[model samples]
Target: MNDLGKLEDLPADYRAELTSHNLVPLWPSLRGVLPPGKPRPNTRATFWAYNTIKPLLLKAGELTPIEKAERRVLVLANPGHGLEKMQASAAMYLGMQLLLPGEWAPSHRHTPNAVRMIVEGEGAYTTVDGEKCPMSRGDLILTPTGLWHEHGHDGDQPVVWLDVLDLPLVYYMEASYHINGERQTVQPGRGDRQYARGGMLPTPVFERSAKTYPMLRYPWAEARAALLTMGEDMPQQEAVQLTYVNPETGEDAENILGFYALMLRPGQSLRLPARSPACVFHVIEGGADITVEDQAFSLTEADTCCAPGYTAVTLKNRHADKPTFVFMADESPLHRKLGVYENRG
Candidate 1:
């Protein structure tokens, strides 16, 4: 009687399923037989870097000898985000570029649109497809897909600027490619060359392509300086930093890969809405303690920090002598598409 063996070899799940469905049809409760969390949903994060990215810019003399001697095209890539899931169409990145007292970022071009915000140091110019424009701190420049460009600074001090490109966009599109120009890197010509060098009434000679980009440079420094001069007695905005717009379309260019500069007087603090795009901050002069998404960071001249999106932000000037000046970036172009807001004048 004890010679009979038990069904130890059979898995419990299979046995239960067989027992339940032996003589049955597809019943509604059959699905309940499985475990509660089997084949779970993907609740993990798709991106790696914090929505906020931090960058530290260098002037010519500040870097090591080796760093200064090389091709000075500095780049900040995704901070290693979207590691697995890979959100390509959307781009989130930041970087700071420094063209020493006499350095140049050679001629090159690729896909995935780009934008730059000049921070400090000037007498630098960027030549896109041979169209040149001297860059000044607080100006905005756009380099759309497939445009050839290069950078050089013949100024006294090193020219440093913020660089924002949607590398993720190129990676996502699976069309990523790059190339280096001649030995000198730049187009071997001087200020006499490029677009800005042409007469005052500047316009693209040949359509560089469709409505790729209208204006090469948006002089943010001059514009912001004017705004301050015009609104000397205006009440300060509580938490909102002013946005820069396209003069023609009134579209908020600041939201796209662009930069905005502001000066905060001593003891003055600005509170900003939480929904704005993540911003990277570089101190131009003086010092400040920034509250990003309520997270705090102490910064001074040459110091760098970042603020994430979907969280409120505030900037407080903590220094007495020099006024604190800050430069920031965001997805301002997309902001225009959504019609959530705009930048005028």
Candidate 2:
């Protein structure tokens, strides 16, 4: 019997020999290294109400300038992810960025892939690699890894967007890099294609050297129309859904990150099968009761919730009318690459 109580009785030289050989005593650390069964993270169904934080965001905008702050963002930390600089969950980072009219977040690019889901306001745009893509509510703007991008708001109201990034993966790989650029604006007529509707890419330009999808902006009008059409054609249980994909190859936008939007009709509920990668869902419209494992989160518009990896989730909308829309981002691609990703009904 390897009794921990007898650890002190062991000879000092013997312990020294174990340490000198760089051996970790199994008795003292076995439980942690190998749990009895499946691993369970400390995370629970967590929610962040936008109404509760809106004033704080406004205050932040009033106190800080885009030039000084570089980017005025409030990171949404997952308490279960630990006390450190937690964002969204353990493997992803989420932040709400505010861009005021007449101000610009200077051009910069980093190794980690990023996406912005517009929460409120309009007439703001992000320039990616010389292409200016306008931003509006419900638009998804991709800031692919290593691409030069800057954000500016020209509208009357402040532009607010939720920033999601695979920053944890970047830190884990220690491959993070940021390069500042001289120009904040892209040349006019660089990205002049009209926003396509009904699952079409306005431009089919594929760069041989590109690391991400060439299309930068996915407008709300197109998404909403397609989703409604999908609702009518697909099973009523999962009414509507769409995944942002690469126009060049018709695959995921990026290998390390994925973005998807879904809609559930009134009084509808669907249980999502478990998968290896965790995800954070931003409530875009209506309200839903999102249950993860045994815990539940009642989420409303502008609110966000999370579902840890491999945890069973069910989304329910009990409203008499109005469908619920959710935008979610996940790190499933990494797990899939490692051959550890799994999903089933």
Candidate 3:
């Protein structure tokens, strides 16, 4: 018998008629379709240890060259969700891509907006539309939709970065498009960081899939300094956060994905109540205890955690020596755009 305990007892002819009309019994689905209380999500909070996956990433790079593999990535799959698909949650997709020295991931552009957060090592750069944005550890880079981009490493050591994209939204709309570039460009132009220049600028026309940031690369040193200044006025117990914004509008609320930086000093714990929209957080430095949806998880430098939508999260910096920094990539922009984003806190 079916879970409802009655659907299977229906007459075969009746079932056939229901199928012919493209209709099915709702009794078996009512529990999910119509719940008793507030809405709950299927996605779960999960964590990935950097130490456990680092060796595997290096091994993959050793076995398969970047040219042959295209993109060598280890996706942080949510245990609550099926592993067959590369996704962090139902709304977001996050992966750790490694680029070995002297290797390159051929240029390609797709519809899903992407944010690259550098985790370990450097001397690697992502070239977007003939402009090369050099990447350093803790740097955040934006690869807007439909922009040709490629990652290459010329440094002595391998480089790894978190690739967060809005895959669920793109797939749902059935608007995915990808095209490979002829070859990696040897020369790349520099982008202007207009916001840093402190000049008034006129509002520019907005396009659906266009460049949002005047500068694609957000360096770590500058971000750190800003966080430090923000901490001066912020309460000691609270976490200091800053969003990577589009200089033209001074907003991080892009069309699909959102990016931000968070810092928590030792003994600081910030609790985020249950909210709708999945978020991928990468540990930039230090260690902490993170509670996601009432489950406890330990995260150290280079580790990653996914707080799925409708899940409560709390971050505690118990380490005695240093501060904990995390880079967050989320689908809040898309949710906000649809006017469905919500939070209980």
Candidate 4:
């Protein structure tokens, strides 16, 4: 193919006029926006060690009070996108949030969808809408778009969790904002318990539950147990993974991102095919060595990493006797919805 014309080839006066009229030529920049083969993603292979983040997060708790800072969080910003952007990927934002004992993150609802992966702590709970979801190590609690949510810690120690949100995407679309609300009245039932068992849902005889988000909190216990059981039952499967989905509709838990729990058997090394969606991996239990493209990361408990789209990734369980469990969030749902999802095996 012939090379496109350059803007420099044009006369100075013509170029000046084009710039003055905000009508620059596209030939010079066409290939940049529509590059051949695949996209050149700004989201790079980045890792955040929990050991390193924990101390900083604890110090942040001491330095800034909840009342003053509102939500004390240390954003896990990717260098590829610049630190000030506070983005882990093109569409995902990640931060480590701390809630000390007796601290309360006031009630507010936002336009971006978010979920909390409890890293460490006890006696901390998040109330979404009206459900008081307890915070335990490895639990995932959703504070979906426009849903009232707040955090409260009753235990005697500090509590911390990984905050994953679709703020970047929403902000880019100019639809990111939140509204403050009064303290919520605790509800009666828990969604995790109501939708506990698989292959069955609460069938309403009269009318279905009006709530758009039926299950807001996904307990790690159930997910871990399911992975262990799957490993035993399907011993031949290379990737013993389970998607966190709505039991009623059998879809991804949230609309913009897909959440999953993956288990690697002892001494297992699994290779994931190159797919057209950026993904974030958080270690829920055990240790694993991960390689994204040419970059490698050694992740332990509570560690988090992000891999760019259209790149193959490899995960290996570091333990010889115990399995490694990882929680993953990806842009697959958004890609599929936009008709651009791909799996280039």
The prediction achieving the highest lDDT against the true structure is 4
Write model 1 residue lDDT over 1-345, tens digit each, in one string. 223334455567866887787743333334445424332211111121211322334433355442345444344432224334332123545556667666666677777666777766778988876657778766777766677777877888767666666665457679878776642333343322223321242344874434335456766555556445534656564322455544434455433454566667667877766553455566655777887543577776645665544455678999765456666655555555667433221
Residue pairs with clashing backbones, model 4 = none
Q: Model 1, stretches more than 4 Å misplaced?
A: 1-90, 101-103, 179-212, 230-233, 254-258, 320-323, 335-345
TM-score winner: 4
Off by over 4 Å in 3: 1-6, 184-189, 197-212
Task: Give a tens-digit lDDT track for model 3, residues 1-345.
Answer: 335746778898999999999999988677776676556566677889999889999999889887788999988887777786677887788888999889878999999888788888978999877778888889888888887899888899989988888886688789977888866565443543434443455345675325455567788888887787778776653769988877666767357778888888767888877777888778898887999856898998999888877777889986866678888887787788889888977
| Local accuracy by lDDT, each model | 0.56, 0.80, 0.80, 0.95
User: Worst lDDT window (10 residues) for model 3?
Assistant: 189-198
Tens digits of per-residue lDDT, candidate 2, 1-345, equal: 434434456688988998899975666665565556445655555778898778899899888877789999888888887647666665688889898888888899999889899999988999988888898888888888888999887889988899999897788888988999867556554222433543454453763434345577888777777787778777544537788887657778777878898988878888888777788889887888999988888888889987887788899985758888889898887778888777854
RMSD of 4: 0.8
TM-score (C-alpha) between model 1 and the true structure = 0.61
Write model 4 residue lDDT over 1-345, tens digit each, in one string: 739888888999999998899997888889988999999999999999999999998898888889999999999999999999999999999999999999899999999999999999899999999999999999999999999999999999899999999999999999999999999999899899999999889989999988888999999999999999999999999999999998778889999999999999999999999999999999999999999988899999999999999999999999999999999999999999999999999
TM-score of 3: 0.90
- Per-model TM-score, in order, reads 0.61, 0.88, 0.90, 0.99
| lDDT for residue 158 in candidate 4, whole number 0-100 | 90
